[model samples]
Target: MANSANALPETGFLRLPQIVGNPHANPPIPAIVPVCRSAWWLGVREGRYPKPVKLGPRTTAWRIEDIRALIASL
Candidate 1:
């Protein structure tokens, strides 16, 4: 699926890799915010980005609406 902000579903969650960009792609695509992983984490820590929800011991994601809001703010 297309990972652009406009292509995200209205209600769901997005993992860090998806939020950053799918690294598995043949040629890496830019993330919505196009920042490095460390920067993204820093944003989360500093409250500049949405906090993630822990879905499982090895799973965490952010709400889609929260991502949309962040995009809009930018």
Candidate 2:
């Protein structure tokens, strides 16, 4: 069976893992794009990736719509 971890939802936000993935987990969370967290952040800083929204004091996430547009551009 294919790993469903890479699958994205139609809407809502995505966390770092749900974007870059956590493949080492027991279920092996898949990645929509294979990238290191540091590089991802760098891309974000460089405007190559989507901007994150501050959900809380320590929470940050990206919108699925933004992510979809990014994937389309890629």
CA lDDT scores, all candidates in order: 0.85, 0.84
Task: For candidate 1, write residues 1-74 as lDDT tens digits.
Answer: 23477798889998887788866787875577778789999999999999999999999999999999998888
Q: Pick the candidate with the highest TM-score.
A: 2
**Can you write out model 2's per-residue Cα lDDT over 1-74, one digit (the tens) per residue?**
12332366778998999888898988987788789999999999999999999999999999988888888777
**lDDT against true structure, model 2:** 0.84
Cα TM-score of candidate 2: 0.87
Weakest 10 consecutive residues, lDDT, candidate 2?
1-10
- Could you estimate the TM-score for every candidate? 0.84, 0.87
Error of 2 at 52 (Å): 0.2
The per-residue C-alpha lDDT of model 2 at residue 46 equals 100
